[model samples]
Each structure stands twice: as C-alpha cells, then as structure tokens.
Target: MANNKSAKKRILTNERNRLQNRFYKSSVRTLTKMFLNSLEIYKTTRTPENKEKVQNTLNSAYSLIDKATKKNVFHKNTAARKKSKLAAQFKTA
Candidate 1:
C-alpha cells in the first residue's frame, strides 16, 4: 500500500502507463502477425494484389513499431530488430 498522497498518485500513474504500454505491445504483435500472414499469402499466391497487401501490412506494422518506440513502449534497438526481421522475411519471399 502507498503510504502518502504522492505515492498513491504514482501508483495510479504507473498503472495507467502499464495499460498503455500493454496496449501498444499487443497491437504491435497483432500487426506483426497480420504482416506475416499476408506475406505467407503472397508467397503462396505470387499475385501482385497479394504483394501489395503484404506491403501494406508491413508498412502498418513498421509504423506501429516506430510509434511504440517513440512512445518509449519499445526500445529503439528492439524496434529496429523487429523491423529488420520483417524486412528480411519479405526479401526472402
């Protein structure tokens, strides 16, 4: 338990930040999954439309990752690593 007003306020603030961070992290994961799925579809189908879809999802995932990094939810190195992996997968496909 918090012993003082400031401590209590800090606890509340921390909880709020935790929730926001969790939302960003989960959203990033979801977007990454969507990107991978689209990439898989593109690999199997080899259609221009599927390639475009993959590109769109990749862009969205990259955007979210950058935003999360900017918000301090993700470290810049972590964000860069994730983006690199995604890009590598895209290139290989």
Candidate 2:
C-alpha cells in the first residue's frame, strides 16, 4: 500500500501506463506478424498483388512503430532496428 497521497497517485498512473503500454506492444506484435506473413506470401507467389500487399503492410507496420516510438512505448533505436529489419526482408524477397 502507498503511505502517501502522491505515492498512491503514482501507483495508479503506473498501472494505467502499464496497461496502455501492453496494448501498444500487442498491437505492434500483430502488425509485425501481418507484415511478415505478407512478405512470406510475396516470396512464394511472386505476384504483383502480393508485392503491393506486402509493401502496404510494411508501410503500415512502419508507421505504427514510429507512433509507438513517439509515444515512448518503444525506444527510437528499437523502432529503427525493426524498420530496418522489415525493409531488409522486403528487399530480399
């Protein structure tokens, strides 16, 4: 238990932030998975449709990661690393 009022408020704020961070983390994971799946499909099918889909997925994932980084949910360097890895995957495929 928090002995002080400010400490109690801090605990409440921390809990809220934790929940919000969890949501962002989950969303990021889902978006990354979607992008990876698109890349895999593109690799196997090699169709123009798949290419476009993969590109769109990659762009969306990148955008979301940037947002997360801006919100402090993710570190800037971590976001950059993820974006770079995604771009490399697209390039290789």
Candidate 3:
C-alpha cells in the first residue's frame, strides 16, 4: 500500500507505464513474427510479390522497434540486436 498521496500517484503512474511498455513489447513481437512468416513464404515461393511483402513487413518491424527504442521501452543495444537478428534471417532466407 502507498503511504502518502505522492506515493499513491507514483504507483498509479508506474502501472500506466508498465501497461504501455507491455503493449509496445507485444506489438514488436507481433511485427517480428509477421516479418519472419512473410520471409518464410518468400523463401518457399521465390516470387517478387512475396519478396516485396517480406520487405514491407521487415520495414514495419524495424520502424516499430525504432519507435520503441526512442520511447525508452527497449534499450538501444537490445533494439540493435533484435534488428540485426531479423536482418540476418532475411538475408539468409
């Protein structure tokens, strides 16, 4: 329990931040999964349309990740590592 008014406000603020962070993290994961799935489809089909889809998903994932990093939801190095991993997978595919 919070002992004072300030403490109560702090608790509420922290909870709001936590939920926002969770939303960002979840969105990042969803976008990453979408990118990977599209990459897989491209690998299987080797079609220009599939390749374009993969590229678009990759760009979207990258944009969301950068936004999360800018908002301080993700550490800069962590964001870099994630982006690197995604890029590597795309290249290999």
Q: Could you tell me every candidate's TM-score relative to the true structure?
A: 0.96, 0.92, 0.95
Residue-wise lDDT of candidate 3 within 1-93, one digit each (tens)?
Answer: 989999999999999999989999999999988998888889889999999999999999999999999989999999999999999999999
Candidate 1 lDDT, 1-93, residue by residue in tens: 999999999999999999999999999999989988888889889999999999999999999999999999999999999999999999999
Q: In candidate 1, which residue pairs get closer than 3 Å at backbone N, Cα or C atoms, i.e. clash?
A: none
lDDT of 1: 0.94
* Of candidates 3 and 2, the better by TM-score: 3
Model with the higher lDDT, candidate 2 or 3:
3
Model 2 Cα lDDT, one tens digit per residue, 1-93:
999999999999999999988988898899889999888888888999999999888888888888889889999999999999989888899
Give residue 41's lDDT in candidate 3 (0 to 100).
87
Ordered from best to worst TM-score, the candidate numbers read: 1, 3, 2
